[model samples]
Target chain A: MSQPEILNQAFELGYTYTRSTGPVVGRFLTGLKNRKLVGIKASDGRVIVPPMEYDPDTAEELSEFVDVGEQGEIVTFAWVKEPREAHPMNEPFAWAMIKLDGADVPMIHCVAAKSESDVTTGARVRAVWADETIGFMTDIRCFELV
Target chain B: MSEEEQEMITKVEAPVYLKYNFTAGSAPTRFLAQIKKGVLAGQRCPKCLAVYIPTRGSCGRCGVPTVEEVELSDKATVQSFTIVSIPIPNNPIEPPFIIANVVPDGANVSFIHLMSECVNEEVHIGQRVQAVWKPEDEWGYSMDNIRYFKPLDEPDVPIELIGKLTVTGEEG
Candidate 1:
């Protein structure tokens, strides 16, 4: 029997594709990567966090970017008793809708808290970004109680 | 593609996580069981009589349920074949390997499998091939039970009869 030629090839069992984030959402997230926050003004003059390209009610095109503050008040939240595998936090935490200093409507994200007893409707929190910030949703690891 | 046209499309990369469950129905359950036991199984349609290797539990032609389970031979006729050369990430096999569709005797539908044993050029569309199974101890509920199909010493079937697996007058 003769030995066959062996070749070294690189392969990975994972997804390989590039997605385009349009100019509007792209700039807003780019701000987060730079440790800065940005918002967009809606047609009725309401500032929106995680900016939208169009006003939902008026169907108006929105582009004016507004710089928002890092600190925000929790509008409403659901406390996790036991975290699911998919949840961002493994320990007891709260998934909250936070109204940042300059935004009109709230943005939804997870909050890191010592206990469920610590979080409340009007509790103040600030963004605690990941050690290495990239233009990713997880770049904001979670908000910590301020 | 021009540089300005390329600039129009911005590319971003991210790792995605997804989870789901597969529900193998009664017919596929039977098929998997046979593979685990080191055998090939198919079901015969009651009306059309066309056999399905991984039985859909119903015949596509008559929409009639297939109930009679039939044992199939490991040997098969190569229906189609292609040699892949371009390297793509996550490909299970390396470049220059053959991916072919082979229909086992008494089975009407063709199933995809890897072809091996002979050098690249000798493989033909009507080639006679037999399943080269993994060691019996390693058999499980997967088509991987048969690692690949190897060329047979017998002559290739006539060109017109090459791809046909269903018996005469039973064509669908």
Candidate 2:
């Protein structure tokens, strides 16, 4: 009789569904489609790009939209030397906290870099848009070093 | 178009995909090895002395580790079942199939498995069944080695005595 092989199985669990992105975030995504950036005013008057629905400090509904610059600074990042199949990029990249000009809070997004050493704190970067823009976060394909 | 409508995205189609790799534990690994040779085996808890098929490494009732290997027969009794009318994605078997919770003889617990080669409507609790194994050349380290359980000609084990039958032909 042959020995039993170690039981290894690969499986996937997922589903597709439609979701409503109400007012605030909807406006920000809409801005990306129009080749622009939008942010909301926080309770402390800080501009938050990819506008949140509520102010973190006051828990009040935020509606004020402020135009933000596409060029930003890398605040911090985690370097991915080897990317997984599910990751956005196949090559080495950095998942960074970027603070766009005119926005006080940093937003998390990936940065395309040739090597780990290419990314650094406080480095200047600019949004790289996709060829065709849709009202989605991927509209800004990635951030590239400026 | 109005300003509100122009800036709004009411809904968006979001598709999600997640992948995982799973490895069977040591107890099931040992059970699969014997299953590859068309033999049924279970592990017995020393504390409670109850045997479990596709052994879970420890006894659920006694909460103690089970180390004794107990050989079981393919003969089983249907403890409960459901007729699936809806199709499952990526499943080779079609809908309207029988999925049963069956207790293999000599084992104290019931495990879920597919039942085929029998009438779907006639399947019921206490129905006698036996494993329908695939060809020897097709055997592997998976439960798919036994394609499915089919009806057996033996008498139905009484509802009260269903999973209590021991390996030595005695009722517990």
Highest TM-score, which number? 2
Report model 2's TM-score to 2 decimal places.
0.76
Q: Which candidate is the best by lDDT?
A: 2
Runs in model 2 lying further than 4 Å from the true structure: A1-23, A30-35, A81-86, A115-120, A132-135, B1-26, B63-67, B82-98, B117-123, B151-159, B167-172
Model 1, A64-129: lDDT tens digits are 989999889999999998999888999989999999999998999999999999999999999999
Task: Give a tens-digit lDDT track for model 1, residues B1-172.
Answer: 2542333323468656445455567778778877888888999998877788877789999988899998887888888888878876666688788889988877878899999886777788878889999999999778999999999887776657653554321222
Clashing pairs in 2: none
Deviating ranges (above 4 Å) for candidate 1 = A1-17, A55-62, B1-16, B20-29, B56-67, B80-89, B96-98, B116-128, B150-172
| DockQ class, candidate 1 | incorrect
Per-residue lDDT tens digits for candidate 2, residues B32-136, read 888888888999999988889888899999899999999998888999999999877667789999999988889988888999999998998999898899999
What's the C-alpha lDDT at position B19 in model 1? 50
DockQ of the candidate models in sequence: 0.16, 0.53
TM-score of chain A of each: 0.86, 0.91
